[model samples]
Target: MFDEMLHWPFFDERHRALRALGDWADSALDDLVAQEHAGGDVYALTPQFVARLGEAGWLRLAASLDGRLDARSICLARDMLARRSGLGEFAFAMQGLGSAAITLFGTPDQRERYLRGVMDGTRIAAFALSEEGAGSNPGEMEMAARRDGDAYVLNGEKTWISNADLAHQYVVFARTGEADGARGLSAFVVEADAPGLSVIERIPVIAPHPLGTLRFDECRVPASAMIGAPGDGFRIAMSVLDVFRSSVGASAVGLARRALDEALKRAAARRIGGRALADYQMTQDKIADMATAIEASALLVYRAAWVKDTTGARTSREAAMAKLFATEQAQGVIDRAVQLFGGLGVTVGMPVESLYREIRALRIYEGTTEVQKLIIASGLLAAASHGN
Candidate 1:
């Protein structure tokens, strides 16, 4: 059903070819998912998953000729990955997210040094921006990067970071003190094993992921490692988010679509008072809602991707709308799926149950639903105030 979406004007022949991502993910990802749920280490599996994606040539899509990412390709790839395995999706998304800074703003030397490893899956990359004081409001982050001759000395703590302990390198943002709040921040590529850096603690979340806190005690990187000019971290981070936010929505759609498919299958199989659950008007209603939400989410996600790919304009409003609507609605859709499955829904190993956990985080990350609302409203007000 999702493959049919490629026919929309939002996509082209190149985009349609990406449907092959789903075929590969569906077949290759299940055994690995089972292994993880059975207590295999998630962090341990990331490299393998990434390596597989790289070997299969999927990771190559994370890059581009003009150094500009294709938003539509990204969204489609994520949709397929999330549908098959949340952890698989995480591995793929982080590659794009982690390297996005370098791809967008780094010097040629930076790109040459870092990007090939990412595309080949020999090294893992992470984006470290969130801090204890700056999850929603990044401007309040306290980490500082002090210029020290030929290098910058970093000292602070970053929490709730993805790929924390496992990533080979991180693109870290810290205050360079050019100004207060977000304006003062700068981005640098820091190796995971840098002398003064350590993975402080691994965080356990509702889903299986490599999340942790990182501490930088006088951690240093060469001055040449800075992604962009001083005080450009905030802009660079926002630009990266603008590129990936719509892909986040596409991931949610994938999760919700999987949930909907599971519910539909269960409805056809489960007997209720001598009739299959699908025969009930109540069950039909739930299925209707789930399908509608999936359709709507896919529409918003692809529309945002289309706008980004076509206009070369900033997609703040479109991406926020897509992320907000798709994530919020997918939550409801998955809950309905769980409801349809009864006890099996809550069972830890079940597909719908796993999806239930996976979908919850989508609402919170990649700019929360509240943040998206603020972004959308702020854009409208800004445009209206100028009479645009």
Candidate 2:
């Protein structure tokens, strides 16, 4: 619907190519969904879905040759996939997030050992940073990793982990130093089959995928498994989030666009009061608001991505703003679509009903809307203080 934005200054030929590839991948989404449904196991279906993306070479966009992430490309990929299928977007996002620490901070040997398998979809990856008590505050984490003679022994639990039981390796963060809060945390690559590592329980969310809690009981990994320095875990996590957060906004924008499209089609075709719903001034107003919100969201999302791509500095403020606005607004747009559809909206097997469920978790995960506001406000206050 908003094809003009594709030609905007923020994007280039490569992004267009990526979008084309996404369109090609989307052509198979129905079959993919059918296969996943038939299998009736989200965890098992994930690898097959990822393998197809890898075969199609779309997963390569998750990481670049120089080991740096391209925010614009990631945003475009998520935007396109989310529009077609939420599961497709999830698969693409986890592949990048699961190994983001290694891509950004791992040694050459670490990258050589993990990145290749991840890119080819031979090995699944997961990021384990959040604990039961530390979903939003990493500083409150209790997971411990003690140094041994030549390895680190880890003991603790990570909850709400995506690809938990299915991942071959995890980028696990745990308290390692004597310092309290974030400084005590360290990041390590812990294999799923590690002696003391096991899935504690599977977590079922409204929109289901492979999610679960992991427990570590004296899990030991080689000293070389550490991503950076002992106290670098928090920084690594934030850096990775800085890159992916804008893409979350992009995905929101995609979802909003799809909602708008559905609303428009319904308004034009559905008859009401002896005329199509589009004839009503109130319906027109709703459509206008949805379109405006979607466009503004797109601008903010891609602008954040563009800034990150052109400048190496972390776009924390921009990313936060984008994610906060896009996700919040997308929820409103989808709700409006549901409203426009009336009883049909909530009916089982309806597209809008499915979308209504899918759009919800975006606001909670990665970072909640409340957390994004705090990040933005803190950044502004810091800037003002510097000016004074």
Candidate 3:
């Protein structure tokens, strides 16, 4: 189904093989989703699924063979699993996002101890950056860490954290001083069983995953848990997001593709005005729009992915553009699919409806549409001011 993407030549033979592996997953994923349904607990089910993905060597692709984050592999895995199942994509992505700090900046000892397990899926990873009061404004976070002896005592609450209950370890960001704003923030690695760490509550969404609030009351972690230097948390957080945000767009493309596929099947089979719905020019127009949206979105997503792979540049602007366009366009495409489906589109258990719910969160998480716009505009204005 993704074969059309080969036209761009953004990928190599190994990437094609990954796509084939993803195609193999299409049949098997129903069983995984069914198993998830039987358990009825995403928290419990996610670790097992992640472990299975690791043992199958798919999770290994989250990082390079030597254990650094692999941009292309991360993008490919997300796009594939997203096409199969939204939850599956979430499970795969958190591993890469959660481990990215260690991959990029961890000490040798840290990588030896943590990243290997993350790559093998023996350890589940979570990125705890968002707080109840600090959604888009990272500077507003109240979570603070103060040093005592060789440990940092973390105190405050982190909300809207994905994999909160299930993560074996979390890369948490907190203010390291009384200084105001983002400058005071630092990142630390906290174990699931660390002192004074607790899950306060689970937050449910339209398309649910493992999510909850994490409270840290004097939660102490060794100083060695800090990634890079203190006062570098903001850069680290932005770097991780810059890399993965494009993949979020890729996932949107996947969801849009599924929505388009379902709509196409319905349009071809359903009769309207004494002929198939596909026979209508209006239906053809909608299909054309959806197809065009997918194609254009794919171009943006892969271009960002490729640029990162080849240039090793900080991709803040490129990633912002990809996420901004693909996600918003996906919303439009899916809406058209639903319109084409009519009442059947809104029906529960329908693929397009699920895609609708799944696609909504992609726009909100990673970065909101509004946030992406700000990033893009700021970059453009900065470049203009520099006469570049």
lDDT of 1 at 309: 82
Steric overlap count per candidate? 0, 0, 0
- Candidate 3 structure quality by residue, lDDT tens digits, 214-256: 9999998999999989898988899888789999998898888
On a 0 to 1 TM-score scale, where does candidate 2 land against the true structure? 0.97
Work out the TM-score per prediction. 0.98, 0.97, 0.96
lDDT of 1 by residue, 141-260 (tens): 999999999999999999988999999899999999999889999999999889999998999998879999999998989999898999999999998998899999999998998898
Consecutive 10-residue window with the lowest summed lDDT within model 2: 33-42
How well does candidate 1 match the true structure in TM-score terms? 0.98
On a 0 to 100 scale, what is the lDDT of residue 335 in model 1? Answer: 99
- Stretches of candidate 3 exceeding 4 Å from the true structure: 35-39, 64-67, 178-180
Shift of residue 126 alpha carbon in model 3, Å:
0.5
Per lDDT, the best of the predicted structures is 1
